[model samples]
Structure formats: structure tokens, C-alpha cells
Target chain A: MKILDIYARLKRDMNYIEKELEKSIYSDYTIMRETSAHLLKAGGKRIRPVFVLLAGQFGNYQLDQIKHVAVPMELIHMASLVHDDVIDDADTRRGQLTVKSKWDNRIAMYTGDYIFAKALGVVTQLPNPWIHQIMSKAIMEMSIGEMEQIRFFFHTGQTIRNYLLRIKRKTALLIAISCQLGAIAANAPKSVSQKLFLFGYNVGMAFQIRDDVLDLCGTEQQIGKPPGSDIKQGNITLPMLLALQEESLREPLLQEIARIQAVDGQTDVSAFIRMIRGSNGIVKAEAMAARYIEKAIVALKDLPDLQAKKDLIRIAHFVGNRSY
Target chain B: MKILDIYARLKRDMNYIEKELEKSIYSDYTIMRETSAHLLKAGGKRIRPVFVLLAGQFGNYQLDQIKHVAVPMELIHMASLVHDDVIDDADTRRGQLTVKSKWDNRIAMYTGDYIFAKALGVVTQLPNPWIHQIMSKAIMEMSIGEMEQIRFFFHTGQTIRNYLLRIKRKTALLIAISCQLGAIAANAPKSVSQKLFLFGYNVGMAFQIRDDVLDLCGTEQQIGKPPGSDIKQGNITLPMLLALQEESLREPLLQEIARIQAVDGQTDVSAFIRMIRGSNGIVKAEAMAARYIEKAIVALKDLPDLQAKKDLIRIAHFVGNRSY
Candidate 1:
């Protein structure tokens, strides 16, 4: 099935999740309500919630039970994004002004905290202690991954293994747990939830790798922000790291990165973007992402063959191949 | 019991709590480890944990069970302080360089997130979902209170009711839950825990009021920061608001505040500090705090007259009358 087809299939349930998201972040404080509502309206693909809903299909498929997992997953994702914007000094996200830009960094910080707390509040309404454990661990890992990103900024000496670990913590773990928790919430067998976790984890890896590659290659309209924002913000992603390994591109790219760092990322990065695009980095990164997608599909092989399984496989492929 | 005697009574368990706090914040990353450890070392009174441990005595009083509540209370407090430093642009807290100052705002933000996640992880080990629910709600209220603080900064029109509400969320809620959760963790009677919550809530109110008054009237050595730091940062405390009501001081105080705002708080605030100190604001704020302490004592009137009850009352008095 196509990505749009899956979203359409889940449209009614997704609407519930969306409204629940809005309700979860509602605050009596005017500025908080405005800032959080601002973030809620600046929509994304809602892929995490989608993954949760699909994974729940493998179980008894109860929307009420699964939304407890789904909404918090999306809320956590939203909270991290707000905090990330503050760290990235980003003004725009998903083609809208960020909380930090629209209000201020302090507002963004507390808004993120408030949303995260709301997410916890929603999830804790579930009676399972295991779900709480997994969610909190994912949050801790994500935070460590965020700090690692800051530490690795402008440092080209980082290995591909470091990049993988960072992205695994920063993105993949939450996705993995979304599937795992969704299945568990709906009373899926432990074996099925474990397999779904592996599937989500591999897909999340591909998803992030594709995102990094798109940062270098996608247009302004396609990516929703300026291309090369990663490099401009000194984030050395997998593609950039892979590109640095090219002997012919290494010296010139290093010099360009050095220049950007010297000016504290004030310079235009179109030249740097062009150089990476012209290199083998794009193809190599795509190949790695395809490998992760393959593993994701393989993880689902042991599960009962259902339409949701096929949809998961299709979503994995879409994540691997999507240009935007 | 004297405060030192209370510490002596709980020394062994408090040591375990201290170690658990260290273990809770442990990270594989060097920077995460160092920043968190630094915060742990630059300790405050650990008053929240003390309340938790003391409140646990009214129940079955298992140190193992109560430490979970105690440690997380302190960790959440630590996490908020780290984030507050980022928002306040504060360099020193408790006579040590703030994480934001020593590293950067990005590091401080993630460090706070990491610590908060760890707190949740520790708390979820307990089987009771109610604890998680209460904890998460307190976190949400605290974040709202933090945002309200920013919203009310330098706004002289804010009433005493607004200030009370802000501090209730920011300070009292967590302390109240610390007592409530501690009792619940130890399997205390519902009525007992409810009363403990009320006791903690009032003491926390008085505790914050005393801290605010000391911020203006105390020396740098006494408060661990500068005397006029609150006014300098545009934090309009109760004493300041009360002082603003004075006919003799209103015009000059407003002018000084305006001048500080004009320069973005870069100028000397000693003149502002002296004016508020010499006014009747301190005496009136003290009276209000004393009322809270009285309420706190009244909360414990029906609890069995154990030594723990006396300790709780003495702690309430200490909070109300603390000079530093």
C-alpha cells in the first residue's frame, strides 16, 4: 500500500490521535497554550503515531487502548523537536515559525517541558509499569543522544559507528518502543511485540539516514527548511561523514567546513551542499538505508502474514526511498 | 527535634539516597556524566528528600520503598535548577558554576532533560501507577509555574494572589507530592497521607517566601548568590510587590526598575535592593509566611503525636524562620 493509502485507512483513528494531542497539551497559561498550540498546528507526517497504530493492528486492535500509547509517542516526539529547535537556533520547522522564534527560547524550553510532562501524564494513565519503564528509558537515551549531537558538532573526527549510535538513541529507540508499546498495550503476544520492535528500530534507522541525505539533496520546498541546515548548524550527519571519506572531496570539504566554523555558521552553504551532492555520499548513504530497510522487512518475516505487515514493509520502503 | 538531629536520625538512609541519586544520573557519555555529577555535588539542603523520608515514618516506613520517592523528588528539583539557570542566564548556583555557564545552554538543557528522565525511570520501578500520575501532574504544574514566572517578570500589576498561585505550582506542589507519595509508598493511611500533603504544601509556601525575602535582605555569603539577583533578573517576589504598594517607595522603585529594564538589567541594583529592604515589605512578607507555618502545624494536629510529627512541625518552623 502507498503511504497516503495507509494514512487514509487510519484517517479516523488518526484524527482522534490528533485531537488527543491537542487536548494533552492544553494549558491554562495563555502563552503556554499559544506556544504549544502553535507547535501542534505546524503539522508533520505523524509517522510515529502511524507506526503505533499499525503495530497495534497486530494485536486486538483497540483504538482506545492503543491511543494511550500513540498520543504519548507523538507528544514525546513533539517535545524533543521543540527542544531541538532551541538547540539548533532554528527559526522555522515544517514551514512554520518555531516556538523559540515565535515567542522566545525560555518559552520554548518550558513549553517543551510542559508537553513532555503531559505526555508522561497520559502514558501513566495506563496501568502497565513496563510501558512507563520503556518510555522513560527512551526519553533518557534521546536526551543523551541530543547532548552527543552537541558534543560532536563541527568535529569531523566522528566515526560512522558514532553517527549510528547517536541516531539510534535520538530517533530509532522511540520509534522502536512506539511499536513495541502499541502491541503491548493492545495485548499482543510478547514475541510479536519484540519482532515489531526490531522492525520499527530498523525502519527508524533508515528513516533518519534518509532524512540526513535529504538535508543535503532536497530543495527548500521539499525539505521545508533550507538545505544544508545540518552542516550550517555544524551537525555532521552520516552523509556528511561519508562524504568526508572521499579522498578527492576531503581537503576542499574540510576547508569549507573550517570556514563555516570560523564564521560560526554565518556563511552561505550552497557551495558546500553542491560539493556533497556531486560526491558519492548520496548513493552510499542510500545504500546503507536500503540495508536497514531490508532488515526491517526481514524482522517482520516471522510474524503472521497480515495486511498490517505488508503495510509495514511498504512504509519501510517508502522511508528508504522518499525524497522528502 | 533539631534539624541536625533529624539529619542524624536519617543519616544511613540519606547516604543510600545520595548514592542512588548518583547512580540514577550515571551516563555512558563523559560530558553527561560530568555535568550531572557536578550538579549533584553542588547540593542544596536536600529538603525535599528529607520531607519524604520523614513523612514515610507515619506509615510502614520501609527505607527501600521510601528512597524511590525521596531520590526522585531531589532529582526533579535538581533538573529544574539546571533549566532555571539556563533561563535566568545565571552563572553561579549554590556557589558553583552553573552547567550552562561552565558548558553552554544546550548542554544545560539536555542535562536537565536527562536528569528528569532518570527520575521517571527510577519512579516507574514502583508498581503503583498513582505515584506516576501524581508525579507527572506535579511536573506539569511546575512547568506552568515556571512559564508564569517568566510571564510575570517585571510586571508590577501582579497581585499577591498571582504570586501565591505561581509559588504553589512552582514550589509547593512538588513538596506536597513528595509527602503524599512518600506516605503512599510506605502504605500509610489515606487520611494520614492527605494531611501530610497539606503540611508539606504549607511549609513549601513558607519555604519559598523565606528564600525570596532572604534573596533581598541576605548577603551573598548567606544566599550563595548576590543579594539583588531576583530584582536584577526582573523576578518580582512577594516582598517586592508588597514594597511596591508603599506610597513613599512606589515612584522611586518603579523608576529604578524602569532604569534596570532600560539597560536590560545591566546597571547596579543595590539602590533597588536597599529601598525594598528598608520598607515594611520584609516584615509583612514574614507575617504571611508565619501564617503558612501556622497552617502547616495545624495540618499535623490530628496525626498521632509521634516524634516524626514533632520533627515535621520543627521543619515547618525552620522553613518559616530560616535566615538563609
Candidate 2:
């Protein structure tokens, strides 16, 4: 019955996961060791690991077994991000120059590979098919999602269902797997694991939606990124699509969209931002996020009485309501 | 004392491996499957799987188990080539238009991912620690080699040792792992497997050196690539480094190097090819390939009396002496 704030607990767990990840990549190549260290130091929210740890608590929860799953899941996340920055041709990540922008695209790609190798190597230590099954499957889905995103970029007619499925593959599904893996590793009952998985899935969907909303509403300092960035990158997020629907605003929107698209895919972005803000896009997005929160909570209602489950529910609520 | 010509046997085995690879990727993504199949079909000697199958025969061999290792290893090789084409921005491969060239970079990247997924999925079926360990580490090395290659592009003063090391990771190590994994999967004694590893390692090193020679000496029709293409790509291959040592040849070499660099960084390349062909670079490179063939034979002296081992040695000699 230890009632600890989720972020604080996440901070504690991430410290160890961070340490283990750093230790794992130590090799004779001093340069590779140093480069990998720089990437780890770049830092991330460690949301995936947090999902894993929390989900483990829903079962018999052995920390030793859970670490194996947690580390690899996070590394996979890290590996994907390095490649992502390259594909996005991004300059800065977390207020620092990305591995790609700093060294080059190739180093970024290898750094990703090094991390993936280290992660997969760790999975071998776990004597089970369950973990490999979940992890490899997750990687496959994430890759397919990325490919679809790349293929469908700037295609305005893509349905919300398609968008949802893509995001599910790209973002939410991994988070869901993290929880499922943690629960299974701890030998948690199948029903408990399924419920935890349901909870993770619903929260993940809402989490990505909130991220899109932040890209529209949150300031550069607020979200650690410039607002309307996705639109600028020609990735039509939910709010931008909603704004696109108002045909009455078509001329001005079209002008702005054309201007953005005209910059050879490097539009100023703020014009669309201003438009989205003025429109009720933000409000509509938040309402949608609220609906997801309700769904996530309902998934948890049948779970065993535990403070950890309550904390998870609280985090989901906060994710929906968090301001810039 | 089985006097079967190893090269002819290898050619037959390679063809079998290629057909199996095509069958493995036959899925619903017809475009992707065909794109991958075309790359596999547009031939290169399937040296890797040949090494794996040959190595497997050293122990308790099973076609079923060995095929899992051999087919996936070849698929991974094919996948890397597909991605390498995009990363290298090369237009043609194996005398055919590259996927990136015929389609686009995004499709090419996805095709690589799809093939990579299929590769891992196939390898995981073996359910052995040794296979995963070898395959995953080989993949990591391949990625690191790629990173190094990208980083060093157009930087001409790198030591011969560094170039060799880079090529080892990029080429030799994967082939070495192919042999080692083959031996391990067949339940060969550790000592036998280690010898097979060394045998493959030396041959792979010589194999790459021969390729560098061919890149300088062979014509497009004979080698499936234009002569001096490596120089055209700003790659300081062994032959280029050897050619640069003569101070008298240095300026013209430097000028050709500069022209190649220009073509690589962005310019027309036909003129650069013209510059390199008009030089003494090719002959010196062939002598170095000859030296490596001798070194590769030295690695096999301790192995047991087996027909597979003898044929492997003969193939290495053939590869070393072959000319376009």
C-alpha cells in the first residue's frame, strides 16, 4: 500500500534502466561507447519503461525478470528514435543536436543498431519464447506503421481510422506490449495481464492524441518544439485535418496550406497554427482525449484493489488534462 | 577426397538458397515481395549461405535447421544491399536498376524493413541461443560498418588498417558468423566450429579484397559494374590507397580523387570513370588480392580431413585469381 507519485517512481526506475543500458554497450570501441553514452545522455521521458514497470505490479511482479523486458523495450524505442530523427531530417532532439545532425545520418543509424543489438542480446538472457514473441512483433508493427506514414505523407484524404491504426502501430502498440510483457514476465494471471494490456492500449491511444494536440496548442518552450510543426513537416495531424474540413474557411486555409507546401515542404507553420487555435480544434481534441480517459478507466474497474492501478488511472487522467 | 569443384557446388547451393529466399518473402505485399525478389534474382554469388551450409556439414547437419540459418542469412544480406543502395544513393546494383532508383527512397527503405523483418522472423524459428546471438551480433556489426562507411565517405587520408577494419565489419564478419552459426546449429564440437569460423573469416577478407580489385579493373559487362566505380564513389579502396602512394602519380590521382569526390558529393560521374581507367591502379590491386588468398589458405591447415574444407580452399583460390 505504498502510495507514490507515478513520475517519481518512474524517475527512480529510469535511473537503474539508464545505468543498465549504459553498462550494456561498454566495448573495446571507445568511440562507439562514447557516442552511445552521448545518445543515452540526450534523455527521453522513459514512458515505455514506466508502462512496463507499472504493469508488472499488477501481477507477482519479479523485478529481476521485469528488467529484461523493460530494458529491451526502451532500447527499441531509443533505436527507433535515432532512425526517426534521420528520416525526419531533424536538427535538434530534446533541445540538443540529434545524433544525425551532430555526427551524420550514418552514425545515427549505427547508434540505433548498436542499441538494438545490445537490447536483443539481453533478451537472450531471458529463457522464454513469450518475450521474444512480443518484442519482435512490436518491432514489425512499428516498422510497418512508419512505412505507412512515410508512404501516406501529405495525403489529406486519409481517414481517421487509418490515422488511428497507423498511430496504434507507430506509438501505442509498443506501450501496450511493454505492459503485457511486464505482466507476463512476473507470471501474472492471464486475466490481470489482459486487463493491464487493455489499460495500456487505451492510455497509449490518448497519449498520442494529446501529443498531436500539444503540437497544435503548446508553445515551443511548453512542448519543447515549435507549435504546428507536424503541419510544417507535411504530416497532417488530427487538428489540422479538422481545420481542413471547414470549407467556408477553404480559401484562406488553402492559401496557407499552399504557402506551407510551397516552401518546398518547409512552410512557416504558424499561419496554420493561428488558424487551428482560432478554430475550436483544441477544444474538440481535448474532448476526444477525455473520452479515451473514460474508456481507460472503465478497463481498470474490474481489476484487483491496488493503489498501483489507481495511480495508473490517475496518470492517464493527467495525460489527457495536462496543459502546455 | 570428394573432388566436386567447390565453386560449381557453391553455385548450385547458392541457386537453391536464392529460390528459397524468393519463396520465404512471398506474401501479400506483392510490390514489396517482387521488389525484394528482383534484388535477390538479379544475382550476386550467394557466398554467405554457401559458407553456412558447408559449415553445417562439419557436424550433425540437418537441411531443415541449416536452411533456417542459411536462408535468413542471405535474406539479411539482400536487405542490407537494398538499404545500402538508398544510403549510398547508388542507381544500379547487380546490373539492374536499384529499388530506390526505380521506385523511390521511401519505398526502398520500407522494402529493406520488410525484408529485415522476414529475416529475423525466419531466424527466430530455430529456438537456439547460438543462432540468435550470432545473427543479431552480425547485424549489429553490419550496421556499425555502414555507419563507419557513411562517416568516412570522401575523407581520403584514412589509414589502410582502418579501411581493412571497416571492410571486415561491413563484409567479412557476417560471412564468418554464417559459418560459425552453421557449425553451432549442427551441434559441431566447439573446436570444429571455431576452425570453420576462422576459415570463413579469412576467405571473406580475401573475398572483399578481390571485389575492390574488380571495382578498379572490371568493366560493367564483365563484373556487372563499371570499372573504377569505387573511385567514382570517392571510396578510398585498397587499390586507391596503393595508387596514392607514388608521389608522381599523386596529383593526377588527387585530381581523379577530387573529380570522384565531386561526383559523389553531387556531379556527373562519367568523366571521373574516364580519369581512373586511364591509370595503373588495377594491376597493383590484383596482387594484393593474391596475397590474401594465400593468407586464407594458411587458416585452414588445422581442420580435419573433410571434402567440404578442401573445396572451400579451392573456391578461395578461384575467387582470388578470377578476373573480369
Candidate 3:
């Protein structure tokens, strides 16, 4: 059960999905084609597609059966980034200029819409009601998560429970469904698909907690985002939520966040980074993420015997335990 | 067939569809629910939903059959408006404040995504692939049309053909699909569905051309938008395109447009309105709209012997011949 083997297979499917995406996005309007191409070029890890492929392997695996969900799920991820960029007032993504940065905000927004429509068009080509239901529900959850983020912004009394829920919906929910839909598309037994979905969901939870950690502790060069950028943007992730819970640290922490808000993009972010890290919040956050990873591993016990299953287990470990 | 009777029927259907929309859009994220509720409050003519219902009558005419199309078609229309308002920097719609204006552009964008997700979710309740295919394609076309509009803004040498193509995709294509999808959902004969689709398509074309006319000549009291606002936004619609064709008027008209570009929300608006109305462009544009209305009437020749069909025919004439 080699992780490399799973990576290779997922990459192959991603290439096919990528080509389909390229062809489907073609339009007589040159700007749509151009802008979509630019956003696509800001490549993602294709993690959702990988989950789709890996989940399919637990059942009657077929590359063709899985590509429908794999492609559209990935496209959904891509579509949301354009809108997210506008919301975040982000200048760069994945070390490249964002869609809104390169073009005006309006064109970037419509480009997101154009990609979303293409995704829906592409997925409905597959003859399955359940697949559409799963994918569309994932989109709904992701949108709600986004709205929640906007609502919670600048709220100093952010609870750890609410933070976890927000992260699950915003970042993990779609990834979870990517796996579940793949299994369903491949005609896996409902139980097998459901187990895989649970595994995916738990891992997604752990993955986002780590992302919050990386935003606070990892160097800007490693992650392509400024350290403490989340707090600056008024997003209180799990780490910040945990840090805010300590009464001794509360007032200074809130004051620092206030200063971050008052400062422009070039504010001294490193001081806040050190404060969060040194307060023992990161350690507690890591332990919480580990619990989710363990839960994900337990969910995998129900899967049918396959090397793909083992690879997924390893990927979960890799996501939660990755140091750099 | 009485137009009032047709309006009554449409109003009933719209009320039910609006309820469905409300139920589908609500989420635990209360902000998403409330923002979408605000957006739905900006009442529209429900023209798309009406087409969906009328077109379904061409098939196995049933209230239930038409609703599946009508609800989603209207939701899709509303979703587009949410995003469009953001793109257009529009402050109002239907004499009410726009979503982007009431909430920031960020909320408007997410609210659009939320509605789009809900629309796609609702459509899957019907077990028909063709409905999804047609509706998805319509959405894709709408996005591309928006791109074309953005790209062509303020370009002086733009032709009438380019303008027509843009509006055809932006405005006409969705209405055409609403008709086709409604019929398809009801299991209407393909030929009848095709005829209704063509009828709707041509009428939509005339509807937009007449809209362009009103944008150039109608008073603010008659139309919510100020006259010549399209040109103010740098979109060279049919009236301006026709005016641009004359050798005597090209440079002076372009100078007027250049002045439009230099100003943000104000210009010598009254003089420009007077100039367009006084020119032969107004008459030529009206003639072009009339052609499409006649074509729409011809497209309805094959509709069934029903009161709904007769009402649709009258609505086409009303849409085309309405001077205000």
C-alpha cells in the first residue's frame, strides 16, 4: 500500500479531468476563456479529486465512473476561490496573482459564475440523481460556511465549538462529499460509501485545523500566505479561539487583533504569530487535530480491503502530522 | 384569452415558486438565509417563470410538471441578478435597493452562490437528465453573455451584430431554455417544445431590443433607470450601434461616449437622451425589434389549441409593441 502509487493514480485521473475542464470552459466570449484559464493556472493540489478517486477504489472502481464527480467537485472548489478572493480582498493565491487582482472584481466574480455553470453542465452529463444531490448539497454547505465566516468576522467572543463547525462546513464539507460521491458513482454499497464519507469528513476537519496552524506558525514562503493573516482578516480559527479562551491572555490578545485590523497589509504580523505560538494554543490545537485524525482512522476500519484504503489512511496521517 | 387571466395564473405560480425558493435558501447560517430573503424581496416581472409554465403547457400540461421548471428558472434568474448587481455597481433593482447595495459586494456574491446552489439542488428533484442539461447550458450561456458585455464596454466601432449576439446569449437564451425545459419536463412532443422555445427566443430578442430603446428614450418615471444609462455604463446597445453606423454621427457620438466615460454617475444626460430620440437610430431600432416580434408570432403557429397558448401569443405582441 504505497502512498506514491495512490498519488500516481490520482494524478492520472486529475490530468483527464483537467483536460475535460479545459474543453468545457470554451466560450465565444474570449474574456471568459482567458480569465478561467488564468484561474485554472493558479493550480490547486487537486485533493478533492484524489479523495474522489480513492473513495471509488473502495467499491467497483472505474476511472470513468469517478471522473464525473471528480471533475465537477474540483471545479466547484475552483469556482469558490474566485469568490473567496473577492471576500478576503486577497491579492495573491498559491503564490500567483488572484483573479480579482489580475482583472477587476466584477469580471473575476462572473468568471467564478461561468466556471460554476460549466461544472453543473459537466456533472449533469452523468446519469445519476444521487450524484447531483451530493454535489449540490456540498456546494450549499460551502456557501453557507462562507456566509458564516462573514457573519463571525470581528466577533471577539468566538467559541471553539463554533470555530470547529465553521471550519468543517467551509473547508472540509466539500472534500468529504468528494469521497462520498465517488463511491456512490462507482456503485459501492451504501454502507461502504457512507464509511468512506465519514473518514473523509473527519480527515477534512483535521486538515483545516492544521491549515489554521500553518497560517499562524508557518513562514510566508512555505504557505504563500502572510503569517497571522487570518486574524488580520478578522477570521478567528481554532488556534485563535483557543488562545482567546485563556483569561490571562484575553485582553492583550483582543487588543493585538484590534491593532492588526487598524494596520494596513504590511503590518508587523510576526509579533502576533509569536504570541499565538508561545501561548500553548498551537499545542492544544495540534492535539485536537490528532483526535480528528484518529477518528478518521477508526472510520476506515469498515472499508473493504484494498491498497487504496491503506493509502488513504496514510494520507490522513500525512495531513494531520505534517510538520513543514 | 385575457392577459389579466394569464397574469393571475402566473401570479399564483410565482407565489408558490417563491415559497419553494424561501424554503430551499434557508440554512443554519442565518445570514445566508436573511440576505437571500432581502434579495427575493426585489420583485421582478417573473417573466422567466411564466415562460417556463407556458412552455410546459405545450407538453403534457400539468401544474406539477411546469413547477419543477418554473421554480428553478426563477431562482436561477434571481441568482444572476445578485451577481449582476455586483458587477454593474447597481444600487437598485425594480425600484428597490439591490443586494450588493444593501449588503456589500461580498454578501451579494455569496448570496448569489447560495441561490445558485439551491436552484441546482431543487432541479434534481425531477428525474430528468435533459432538464439539467438544458438549464445548465442556459446558465453557461448567460455567464458568457455577461463576459461579452464586459469586454465590449465603450468600444466605439462595435457593430449591431455583436450587440445582438451579446444580448441574445445574456437575455434571450435563458428565456428560450425556460420554455424548452418546461415542455421537456412535462413530456411535451419535441416539435411543440421546439416551436415554443423558438417563440420564446424571438420574443426575448424583441423584448431586449425594446428594452434597449427604452433605455435610450424612456423617462426615469416610466423606467426605473434613467434614459441612456446603458450608454452611460459604456455598453453600446442597438440604438447607439445604429447611431454609430452613420458617417455624419460617428465622431460626435463617440465624443459623447468619451464624456460618459469621464464622468462617474453624471453627464449631460438630458442632451444625450434628446439626441438619440431625435436621430433615425430610434426608428431603425424599433423596426428591428418589430421584426423579431413578427418572427415570434410565426414561431407560435404550431402551439396547441389552448387558452395558455393564445395568451402567450398576446404577451409576445404586448412585449414588442409596448412603447413605454
The candidate scoring highest on lDDT is 1
* Tens-digit lDDT track of model 2 for B85-178: 8777788887799998987776776577666666766777778877788787888788778877766666778878888898889998888888
Tens-digit lDDT track for model 1 on A156-208? Answer: 99999999999999999999999899899989999999999999999999999
TM-score of 1: 0.99
Estimate, for each residue in A1-324, the C-alpha lDDT of model 2 and write its tens digit: 222367776676767877877777665665577667777788777777787888888888776778888888888888888878878888887777888888877677667766776777777667676677677667767777777787667767777777788888888888888878888888888888787777778888888888999888887787776677677777776776677677876568767877777785665677678888887667776787788878888988998778678778887887777654
Residue range B150-237, candidate 3, lDDT tens digits: 8888887777888889899999988888888888988988898888889889988998999889888777777786677787777888
Candidate 3 residue pairs that clash: B59-B188
Q: What does DockQ come to for candidate 2?
A: 0.48
Candidate 2 regions exceeding 4 Å error are A1-4, A10-12, A250-255, B1-20, B23-31, B258-284, B302-307
Candidate 3 residue runs with Cα over 4 Å from true position: A1-5, A9-11, A263-266, B9-14, B265-268
Candidate 1 Cα outliers beyond 4 Å, as residue runs: none
Name the top DockQ candidate.
1
* Docking quality (DockQ) of candidate 1: 0.84
Candidate 2 TM-score for chain A: 0.93
| Candidate 1 residue lDDT tens string, B66-159 | 8888998999999999999999999999789999999999999999998888888888788788888899989989998998898888888999
Q: Every model's DockQ, to 2 decimals?
A: 0.84, 0.48, 0.75
Candidates in order have lDDT scores of 0.91, 0.75, 0.82
Report RMSD (Å) for each prediction in the order shown: 1.1, 3.3, 2.0
Better of 1 and 2 by TM-score: 1
